[model samples]
Target: MLILAPMEGLLDHGLRTALTRVDGVDRCVSEFIRITDQLLPLRSFTRIVPELLRGSRTPSGVPVRPQLLGSDPACLADNAARLAELQPAGIDLNFGCPAKTVNRHRGGVVLMDEPELMQAIVAAVRRAVPAHIAVSAKMRLGIDDERRALECAQALEAGGASELAVHARTKAQGYRPPAYWESIATVRQGVRLPVIANGDIWTVEDALRCRAVTGCSALMLGRGLVRRPALARAIRWHDAGRPMADADVDPCVAALPWPQVLPLLAEFWQDVCGRVERRHRAGRLKQWLNHLRHAYPEAQQAFDALRASNEPEAIAAWLLQHQELAALAARAPEVEMTA
Candidate 1:
C-alpha cells in the first residue's frame, strides 16, 4: 500500500486533491491537528481536513485518515472522539514529527522518549473512538537514537494501535539521507501489528529496496511524491511486472512526461488560487514548482521564469501560455523520416 504522508505545511487539501487524481495512491493522512488544553470546535477539524465534509475522501476518492498531535492523553482522546463524529476514514496519532517547535511543546517526536505516555495516548484515543474507527500511529526511531525503537513500537501496538508507520529516523537524524530501514525491520519483527516503512523512498528501486529491507509491504511517501507526482503509479507499475525501458534512461519518463505534468500543475494552481490568500498564492505555485524541478527540466525552467513574480495574475498568465504550448505540441503531427 502506498500512503501519502501528511506534510504539515506543504501538502494541504488542494495539493492532496491534485496528487491523488493520478493513479496508485491508496490513502492519505491529513496534516497533524495540534490539540492543546481545550476541546476544539468541530469547525476546527473540518477546517484542517475539509475531506471530513466529503466522507473523509479526496475529490478523487482516496480515503484520508485524520491525524492528531499532542502530548495530553485525555485531551487528545477528547478531540479524537469529537473527530470521530465526522466519520473520518481513520484516526492517526502523530509521534513522528521532527520539528523543534513541536518538540518544545512536548508533542511530536519527543513523545518517543516516553513510550509509556505514548501508549497511554494511543489507548485513550482507541477507547474514545468507536470500534469501527481504526486507530493508527506514526513514530520515528527515537528522540536521539534507536535504543527505544522496538519498545515504542510495542507500546503503540499494546496500546491498541491497529497499525504503525515508522519513519526510520530519529529526531536527531531529521530528514537526513540513509534512513535506517534495518532498524525498521527490527521494530516490525518486535510488533504484531502491520508496520509501514517510511522515509527516503525516492524511486521505484528505493521503494523495492525499502520493502525488501524492512520486510514491510506498505510505504508512506512525503517529499518523494511531492517531487514526482506519479511516483506511486510508477511503483505500482514496477510491482505489477510491467516493463519500463525508459526508466533508467530518464527518471522523468518513469513517472510523468513534462507535457503530461502540465495539467496537474494547472489543477494545483487553480486550487491554490481559491484556497490561499492573494499574497501567498504565487509562493504556493513556486513552492510546488521547486519540488517538481527534481524530476522535470521543464519545471526548472518554469521556476526560473516565475521566481521574480509574486503576482497571481502573472502566474496565471504563465500557466495559460505553457498550457497552450503543450496543447499545440500535442496537436502537431510527428514527421516520419524516409529511410
Candidate 2:
C-alpha cells in the first residue's frame, strides 16, 4: 500500500485535493495540528483540514486522517476525544517530527528517550477514541540511537497503535541521506502491527530495496512523492509487471521532452490562492514550485521567473501568458485519471 506522509507546511487540504486525483495514493495524513494546551475549537480543525466536513476525504475521495502533535498525554487525549466527536477517519499521533522548536517544547522526537511514556500517550489516545476509530503513530527510530528503535516500536504496538510508520532515521540524523532500512527490519521484528517504512524513498528501485530489507507491506512517501509525482504509480506498475511508460503517463515522472508540469503547478497556485491569505499566496506558490524542480528540472527557471512577484494573480498570469508555457499547455494531453 502507498501512503502519503504528513508533510508540514506543504500538503494542506487544497494541494491534497489535487494530488489525490492521481492513482496509487491510498490515503494521506493531515499536516500535524499543534495542540499546545487546550482543546482547539471546531473552527481550528475545520481550518486545518476542511475535508473533515466532507467525510474526511479529499475532493478525489482519498481518506485524510488528522495527525495530532503534542506532549501532554492527558491533554492530547482530551483533545483527541473531542476530535473523535468530529468522526475523523482515523487519529494519528506525531512522535516523528525533528524540528528543534518542537523538541524544545517536549513534543516530538524528544519523547523517544522514554519508551514507556510514548506508550502511555498512545494508550491514552486509544482509550479516548472509540474502538472503531483507527489509532496510529508516526515516529523515528530514536533520539540519537537505534538501540531503542525496537523498544519504541514495541511500546507503541503494546500501547494500542494499530499501525506504525517509522521514518527510519534517528532524531539526530534529521533527514540525512542513507535511511536506515536495515533498522526498519529490526523494528518490524519487534512490532506485531503493520509497520510502514518511511524515509528517502525517491524511486521505484529505492522502494524495492526498502520493502526487501524491512519486509514491510507498506511504504510512506513525502518529499520523494513531490519530486516524482508518479513515483507511487510507477512502483505499483513495476509490481504488477506492467510497462513503465504507457500513453497518458504523468509526463513529468516519465521524463518526457517538454513535459507539462506547469499546469499542475498552476493548479496548486490557484488552490493556495483560494485558501490562503493574499499576503501568503505567492510564497507558498514559490515554495511548491521550488520543490517540483527536484523532479522536473525545468521548474527552476519557472520558479526563477517569479522571484520578484508577490501578487497571486500576476504570478499565475506569468505562467498562463508566457509563450513557451502557452504552447506547452496547448499541446498538453488532458489529464485522464487512472483507475
Q: What is the C-alpha lDDT of each candidate?
A: 0.92, 0.84
TM-scores of the models, in the order given: 0.97, 0.91
Model 2, residue pairs in steric clash: none
Candidate 1 lDDT, tens digit per residue, 114-166? 99999999999999999999999999999989999999999999999999999
Q: Pick the candidate with the highest lDDT.
A: 1
TM-score of 2: 0.91
Give per-residue lDDT, candidate 2, residue 314.
Answer: 89
Which regions of candidate 2 deviate over 4 angstroms?
245-252, 255-260, 322-339
Most accurate candidate by TM-score: 1
- Per-candidate clash tally: 0, 0
